[model samples]
Target: MARPTMEDVAARAGVSRALVSLVMRGSPKVSAARRAAVLTAAAELGYSPHAMARSLASRTSHVLGVMVSDLHNPFWAEVVDGLDGHARAAGFELVINTGGRSPARERRALRSLTSFRPAGIALLGPVVPSPAITAAADIPLVLISRSSRLSTVDTVNDDGRAGSALAVDHLVALGHRHIVHIDGGTGSQAAPRRTGYRLAMARYGLAPRVVHGEYTEAAGAAAIRALRRPFTAVIAANDLNAVGVLSALAEAGLRVPADVSVVGYDNTWLAALRHIGLTTIDQPRAEMGRLAASALISRVRGERTKPVRHLLRPTLVTRATTGPPPAPDPMP
Candidate 1:
C-alpha cells in the first residue's frame, strides 16, 4: 500500500493541501473545526509529518535531538523521560541515539544529530572532547551529567565531589574506616568524585584505596574480585556497578554489611528496586533533565547567549546495603 500524504489528508477532509499544511504546522490561523477535521483525516490515513524534511524546507524545526553515552544504564533513561515530557509540552518532539560509551562513536552520533538541523541538541554524559562539543554550538546545545569550560554551551550536573563526600560520611558514620572506591576512569564526572573520595578519606585520617574501573557492571564485579585484602566497605561507581559488586560478593560468600558495606552513586530505578534495595546518592535525575531541556530551548529561542551552568547537590539514601563494619574476628 502507498503511504498517505498531505494531499490524501486534504482530499479526505474536503480541504486544500495548504489548509492541511497550516494545521500540520499548528498555525493559529486555522479554524478550530477545520483543524480537528484535518487531524482526524490525517490520523485515519496514518499520515504523519516528516520532521527532517519539514525542517529543511521551512528553516524551522519542532524537533530536538538527544545523544546518550550509554543505553544500558537506567539513570539516563529516567532523565530522558523528564526531557521528553517538557519538550512535548513546549510543542517540540525528540529523537534519541546512544554512543555506548565510545568517544569515537559519540562524535559520530553528535554529527548525525546536527545533520538534522534540530532546534537544539542535548548530550547526556558524552565522552567526546570539548572541541567537538564546541563545534556543535552552531545550534543550541546543552549537556547533562557532564561539564565543559566552553562559554557557548550550557551544562547541568550534580556536584559529584559533594556526592562522593556524602557516601564517605555515611560509611564513616556507620563505623567503616577501611573503605575502597571503585573508580570510573575517564568516564564523565569521574575525576571529581575520585578526588572527593580521596580528600574525604584523608580528612577522616584513613588511607584511600582506588581500583580503576569503567562505568559498567562487569568492571565493578571484576574490580571487586581483584581486591586482595578484606576491606570493610566498597563504594561503587554507580548503582548498576554496585549491583554487580553485590553479585561478586555473594559468589565470594561475603555477606553485605556483615562482611562489607556497599555504597553506589546515582540513585536510579535499579537502586530503588525491591530486590536490589541499594544504598546510593541521589542526583535528582529528572530535574537535571528538565533544566537541560529548558536551557537548550532558551538558547534556541535566542533568550540567552551566555551559558547556563546548573549545578545540583546530591543527597545520600541509606538502605539495606550499608551498615556498621564487621567485627575483627570472623564468625564461625
Candidate 2:
C-alpha cells in the first residue's frame, strides 16, 4: 500500500499544501478550525510528517537522544520515565539506547546518538571517557549520575558521599561497630561514596572494610562470600547488589538485621518491593531526570552557553533490612 502524504491530507481537508505544512509545524498562523480539520484529516489518512526530513529542512530537531549505561538496572528505567514525560510535555521526543555498562559500548552509543543530529543528548550513568563526552558536546548535552570537568556539558547528580554517610550512620546508630562496604567497582560516582564510607567509619572510631565489587547482584554475593570475617552490617553498592547480599546471607543461615543488617543505594523499585524491603539511599532518580532534561532543553533553545551543574542531596529510606545488631553470641 502507498504511504499517505501531506498532499493527501491537504486534499481531504480542503486546504492547500502550504496550510497543511503550517499546521504540521504547529504554527499559530492557522485558524483553530483549519488546524483541527487538517489534524483530523492527517490522522484519518495515517499521514505524519517525516521527522528527519523536516529537521534537515528547518535545521532544527524536535528529538532528544538519551544514552543509558545499564538497561537491566531499574533505577535508570525510573529516571527515563521522568525524562520522557518532561521531554514530551516540552514538545520533544526521546530516542534511547544503552551501553550495558561498557566503556567501549558507551562510546559507540554516544556516537550513534550524535549521528542522529538531535537537538540535545542526555547520558545516564555513562562510563565513557571524558574525552568522548567532551567531543560529543557539539550539541547540548546533559549527564546524569556522573560528573565531568567539561565546560560545554551540564551534569545532574545525587550526593553519593552523603548517601553513603547516611548508610554508615544508620549502621553506627544501630550499635554496629563492625561494618563493611561493598564498593561499586569502576561504576560512575563510586569514588565519592567509598570515600564517604571510609570517612564516616573513621569518624565513629570504627575500622572500615571494603570489598571491591561491581554494581550487580552477582558482585554483591561474591563480595559477601569473599569476606574474611562476619561483620554486623553490610552496605552493598546498590539495591541489586543488596539483593545478592540477602541471597548469600540466607545461604549462610544468617538472617538480615538479626545477624547482619544490609543497606543498599539507589532506592529503586526493587528496593520498595514487599519481598525485598531493602533499606537504601534515595537518589531522587525522577527529579534528577527532570532536571537533566530541563537543562538540556535550555541549551537546545540557545538560552545559555555556560554549563549548569545540578547536585541534589540524597535521602535514606529505612526499611526492614536494617535493625539493631545481634548479641555477639546469639548463635550459641
Candidate 3:
C-alpha cells in the first residue's frame, strides 16, 4: 500500500483536510483538542506528510542540500559536523552527496541537489568551474573552501595565502633556508596558497621551489621522490599530503626533524595523532561551515542580495615534526 497522507489522517480523525494541514503546519489557530486528535490519527495510520508537497503549497522549503567534494577527507567530515548542527537547530534538513573531487562528477552532483529545489545549497570544497557555479543562480547558494566572483554565490574560506606564509615563516625561524613546497595543483584552494608561499620566499630573500602536485598523500610521496635538491624543510599542500611526505622520507631513511622538517596545511585530526604529531597551519574548518550555512540561509530568507565573502585567519600549530636544522659537520 502507498504511504498514507494528510487526507488519510483527516478521514480517520473525522476532520477536514484543511484542518489536517493547519495542524501539520503547527498553526496556533487550531484548538488543542482537535490538534491532538489529528496527531493521534496520523500516528495510528502511519501517515507522514510529504515534505516537498507541503513546501510547494507554502512556497517555501526547509530542506538544505549539501555537496561535499571528497568524502574520504577527514577535514570535510569535521566541516559537515558544524554545518549539520547549525542547519538542524534552525529547522532545516540536509541531503548530502559527493563529487570525488572531479569537475564532471561535481557538476552532476550540483544538478542532483538543485533538482529538489531546496531552500539553499552548500558546496563544500567544490572543484567545479565558475560558469557552473553561476548557472545555479535561481537558488541561494554558498561555497565553502572554494571561491566565486559571481554575485549570486556567497563564499567562506580561510586566508590560504596567510596560512602558507605562516608555514614558511615557521620553518625559516627554525633555521631552514632550502625549503620546498608541494603544491595542490588544480585543487580549489591551491592558487592562493602557492602565491603566498612564493611571496614569503621573496620577502625572506630565498628562492621559492614549488613541486606541482595535487592534494593527496600519493601526490605528496611522488612529489618528494621527484625532488632532486636536498632541502632541510618541506611544506606539503595539506595534512594528507604531508603524511605521504613523511612516508616517502621514511622509505629513504631520512629521519623527520633530525635530517628534515615538515609542515602541513589544514591541521586535520590525523596531524594531531600521537604517532603523527605533524606541525601544520590550522584553518577553523567548523567555523567556516557555520558561516557558510548562515550565509546561505540568509539568502534563502531573502535577507540579503549581496554576496558574503568570509576570509578567516589561520594559525600555526607547532609539533614534533618541526625543529631546527641539523648541525653542520665539523671541519675534517
Clashes of 1: 0
lDDT of 2 by residue, 1-332 (tens): 79998889999999999999898887999999999999999999999898776787668899999999999889999999989989999998898999889999999999998888899999999999888998888888999989987888999998888899999999899899999999989999889999999999999999899999989999999988878675889999999999999999999889987999999999999999998899999998889889999999999888888999898999999999999998777554
Please give the distance, in angstroms, between residue 206's alpha carbon in candidate 1 and its true position after superposition: 0.8
Candidates in descending TM-score order: 1, 2, 3
lDDT (C-alpha) at residue 314 in model 2: 93
lDDT of each: 0.91, 0.92, 0.92
Top TM-score prediction, candidate number: 1
The TM-score of predicted model 3 comes to 0.94
Q: Estimate each model's TM-score.
A: 0.95, 0.95, 0.94
Which 10 consecutive residues of model 1 have the lowest summed lDDT? 49-58
Candidate 3: which pairs clash?
Answer: none
Model 3, range 1-332, lDDT digits (tens) per residue?
98998889999999999999999988999999999999999999988777778787887898899999988778898888889888988888888999999999999999998888789999999999878888986798999988888888899999999999999999999999999999999998999999999999999999999999988999999998988866999999999999999999999889999999999999989999999999999998889889988998899888999999999999999999999989888989
Candidate 1 regions with alpha-carbon error over 4 angstroms: 31-37, 330-332
Residue-level lDDT for 240 in candidate 1 = 85
Residue 234 in candidate 3 has what lDDT? 96
